[model samples]
Target: MDNSLAELDARVSGCRACPRLVDWREEVARTKRAAFADWTYWGRPVPGFGPPDASLLVIGLAPAAHGGNRTGRMFTGDRSGDVLYAALHEVGLASQPTSLSVDDGLTLYGVRVTSPVHCAPPDNKPTPWERDTCRPWLVTELKLLRPTLRAVVVLGAFGWQAALPAFAEAGWTVPRPRPAFSHGARIALESPTNNPLELFGCFHVSQRNTFTRRLTPEMLRNVLRTAAEAAGLPTRPYAG
Candidate 1:
């Protein structure tokens, strides 16, 4: 791990940006202690997953109840991660079929995934203060990863909103009418260095979305395929 990432990991492991959230998450973990007794409660913040030199960054809203909160890796040990890793594998971004745990031997080839709020908020909803406190980490990560970043795929509206300001700070203007969060909408912007950073918006692959057929595997795969294409990477067909 790079020094920056190491610093981020340390910060996340001891974050107390929001005392209410901290208390709430700990309470939830304690109540479910019997179920997850063996699990280590990060109980602080959650950091990004995958290599530091990745070309793609996947931004999500926050950690899930039993997913990232328990597993300590963003998008791990959850239903949403199941669909996400599957799509990542199909798009040649990940080296594994699924992400169930931190030590699952999963690896992202050219991509990384992270959430704006690292800790699991009560009811999966983070407060504005918590989001504000955590925004700097995302900005720092973007700056560190900018050299290699070619595309950023936001999982939902929250992710899009949190990430857009950073792009603007980097001198990227938002396009007219704005880019909406559909399954396959694409937005293009130039970084301060004049490198193009393609932004693709997709509905989150949450249980609510997938189980309700709001976002299907095919639709998610198509968004990733388009992102890969925009980044000048060859797209692979979805195996399923």
Candidate 2:
């Protein structure tokens, strides 16, 4: 498969590879959250929502059941998206700070947001088998993006664990002794065909982290800004 972004997206969104995930996502959509009862949910897998030539890729764990599964976009209609996009906007990567819907006019300048698992998993977790089954999609995405992809920002430990191998499969040299996942953790890898790819780790933007101050707005913004600048993206005009 050529695996162009469009091809990958269409293929990914239609996948029924994991029966457990399929059942859970559709069930949630059918039952519907009380807050989003009237909403028509997106029970299928969600695709990456960003430009095709993005230089920075953001990998999250998976769609929040009612969040992406309902809104048909990564991190949309949720508090986590609230924190993440606000940081992107602060750093000038996003045109707006909020992503309420798929067509809400929020745009990323040079960044792409995706996940290891496309479907919302039961209990916010996907089994190892499910992740492996979905790995090829991510591998294809990295292969297509590597020419311009300078950095990858991992939202949580699951993404950190999931991404390193996919990147290696795409021919990036991950360190032999894997680096631990911590806020601000960074590793520079030599890509076989492109410039070195940098890896960054950050605590997930879950409400628990933000409300408890484990991941503050400033901290998230600083890491994203630093990574974007390192990726050789144009500086935001008038950033004081």
lDDT winner among the candidates? 2
lDDT of 2 by residue, 1-240 (tens): 555898899999999999999999999999998999899999999999899999999999999999999999999999999999988998889999999999899889999999999999998889999999999989999888877889889998999999889988888888989887999998999965867988999999988899999999988988898889888886464354
Task: Give all candidates' CA lDDT scores.
Answer: 0.79, 0.91
- Which runs of model 1 end up more than 4 angstroms from their true locations? 1-3, 176-178
Off by over 4 Å in 2: 237-240
Cα lDDT for residue 78, candidate 1:
81
lDDT of 1 by residue, 139-233 (tens): 77777777778888899887787777766655567776666676677888865574688999999888889999899888888888887777666
The TM-score leader among the candidates is 2
